[model samples]
Target: MTTAYYTHADCKRHEMGSWHPESPERLQAIEDQLIASRINTLLDYREAPAALESDLARVHTADAIYRIRENCPSERSEYDHFPLDADTSLNAYTWRASLRAAGAAVAATDAVIDAEIENAFCAIRPPGHHATSKEAMGFCMFNNVAVAAKHALEVRGLQRVAIVDFDVHHGNGTEEIFNGDQRVLMVSFFQHPYYPYSGTEHPASNMVNVPVPAHSYGNVIRELVSERWLPALEAFKPEMIFISAGFDAHREDDMGQLGLVEADYAWITQQIMRVAKTHSHGRIVSCLEGGYNLSALARSVTAHVKILADLE
Candidate 1:
């Protein structure tokens, strides 16, 4: 089995600020670990192509797209920022970076569905799980995985796709976009009462949202995945699997209080792989979501990708 790695140099150019946890260095850190672990050369590497407007339209509203583009600074020297929310902002390169990130998802999906690779992982940033159809929130500009999931079904003709979001925060945007769509099933675990604070309420039937309390541990996630994620994934029998892989739940990342470690990330990845092996014929596409601390993020991502690439 081979894993395809997708990323872009523009992804490193879109910086929110000096203080933002979701910085360009996050991607660099992930790459550093991949090289250190000797996993970088073990798979196919590709520059992520920019996603087409048509693909993005599958999950985002035209108004939102217009507003996002309109908000982009004309040039790097033209402006410092245009805040989307208190957390998200538009720098000069944000628009292109967002497009590349979304495009990376689409590219990964195509590669996997076309059987060119066993699976794929997108290291592009500006995480998407928090972006809703109409608004950008929580450091996300476009719903990357949602666009890919839609592309898988609408363009690639896949009947069913499963999205597994294990970010420390709920994938509220993904749930909202694919809420009642029978073609997709989104399973996730996030800390309750967290940022954007809305997943604990009434969720759609297709959404399997398990809320974790603050200070929880990886064991909690393991039990939940075994009891909640696997059965639903098996029953749905998805033709393709997409993971909203986030490492913020790690013990070393101060982004959340989940207390998970690299081992936990690898464990969950293995479980997801097994499910894909059974139902999706090993077709999987994982996109980076949240991981703050450089060291922990790198280690956690290396662990996750090692299993995905069969380098473990």
Candidate 2:
């Protein structure tokens, strides 16, 4: 499989702070691991282009887009930060980086649909899935996967798509954006009683929000995917699959209390690939979301991408 690895240098410059867990070093670490594992040479590497304003308009309101664009601290010092929320901050490079992050997803979607590649993995940040249509929060500036899903449906003329989120925290933004939209089916399992918790209560029918408890191990996750996510995905028979790829649930990651390891990630990705192969013509686009512990995040991503690239 010709898997494209999409990323950009601008994505590495959108720093919140030196102490933030979602640092640019996270991308660097993933790259290091991919190189160390000898997986980098097997895939196609592409620079992420800036997303057009029209692309942003598909999923974000004009006001919301204006707010983010106007809030860039371009003329300020390197240390200056414009806070979007308590956790999310915009540095001078954030605007450009946000465009690049979202753009990577859009470009990857187009590339996959055009059959230029079998699948893709976007190593981008500030991690999305937390940013909503109306607001940016939780260290996220834009809903990258949501934007790409919209692109596939609205721009590319696809009728249906599925989003699989394995992040430790709920993808409140993604759920909200496509809540009542019939064209997309979202399946996710997050730590209940966790940060930005909103997936459990009466989500729309299109959303399969399975809330697992903290300290839940990989087996619990695997079982839920088989029993819950798989059924919905098979029933939906999506034309494409989008993944909010997050590694924060790793046992070694302090971002959340979950016992997932690299093997678990590989298995989950394999399952997604199976579904994609059966229904979506092996078309999948995955975007980075959250992962704190650098070592764990790097290893887990390497494992996940190995499966995406069919290296295993």
Candidate 3:
């Protein structure tokens, strides 16, 4: 079976502002790199559908959903920003694109569950690791991975699902949604004293949060995963795995100081693949989170997707 690649053009239509780091160009970067690397030829491409309100309600409250929907402007020239905390902004196409981005996760989950594909990667954006159930923050509208995880358990009747977040920033939103849910295991590594800086203290039992120092190298991350993530993941014996795949830790990306290179991302993907192979029957679904610098983001994602597509 081939890996499924899920994306939509409407994802490119969602924009916060001209100067926002989480720009539409991020998706274009990954698409261009995948095409140039000939990696697109290795996978099955699928169009992402817009998520229904019920699907979104699995992770976010109806009121929060209504607020986001109400905030989306009707025209591009019109400006109405609904502040979900401080950083996240809702523009004209934000609601539709957010639905499509979340929909990509649901579609990917469905593909993997039905064995239509062994794995899937969602290359959409306004990344979603930061939006919690009641609020949105850090460039996220709805929690895409959380919604997928919820679907895997509630809809697919899976006993266990694991979410591995390798974003430079903490997946606080995901943790908030799944903190007490025993059916889910979340293992993540992020730079401490960074944006949304709360992962370092009083984390939930189900969360394996490794808050590494800034300027740390890939070796540090590798060691943390080896010591913390693998053991917990093996013990959990998850039936499927989800990845919040973020590449901002790359040395060239100014978003974070962690000195990760492209090979580091490839190595992490290989490690996750091993776990998936051994426990989850190679069932893995990955969604994009954060990566700002165009060149570094594209190159790092190329490396990550090469392994996900089994092209490497």
Summarize candidate 3's per-residue lDDT along 1-312 as a digit string, tens digits: 588889999899888778889999999988899899987888799999999899999999989899999877777554655556556787778888999999999999998999999999999877999999998889998999999999999999999999999999999999999987899999999999898888888887899999999999989988998899999999999999999999999999899999999999999899899999999999999999999999999999889888987888
lDDT score of residue 158 within candidate 3? 97
After superposition, the stretches of candidate 3 with alpha carbons farther than 4 Å from their true spots are 76-85
Model 3 lDDT on a 0 to 1 scale? 0.91
Best by TM-score: 2
Candidate scoring better on TM-score of 1 and 3 = 1
| C-alpha lDDT (0 to 100) for residue 164 of candidate 1 | 96
What are the runs in model 2 whose C-alpha is more than 4 Å off? none
Residue 253 lDDT in candidate 1: 82
lDDT, residue 134, model 2 = 90
lDDT of 2 by residue, 1-312 (tens): 899999999998889889999999999999999999998999999999999989988888888888889988865586789887888888989889999999999999999999999999999987889888998989888899999999999899999999999999999999999999999999999999999978988999999999999999999999999999999999999999999999999999999999999999999999999999999999999999999999999999999999999889
Per-residue lDDT tens digits for candidate 1, residues 1-312, read: 899999999999888889999999999999988899887889799999998888889889999898888888878454488988788999988889999999999999998999999999999889999999999989999999999999999999999999999889999899999989999999999998898687778888788999989999988889999999999998999999999998999988888989899889899999989989998989999999999999999999899999999887
The estimated TM-scores of all candidates read 0.98, 0.99, 0.97
Question: Candidate order by TM-score, highest to lowest?
Answer: 2, 1, 3
lDDT of 2 at 76: 56
Which structure is stronger by lDDT: 1 or 3? 1
Error of 2 at 301 (Å): 0.4
Which of the numbered candidates is closest to the native, going by highest lDDT? 2
Worst 10 residues of 1 by lDDT: 71-80
Q: What is the lDDT for 40 in model 1?
A: 89
Give the candidates in order of lDDT, highest first: 2, 1, 3
Cα deviation of 204, candidate 2, in Å: 0.6
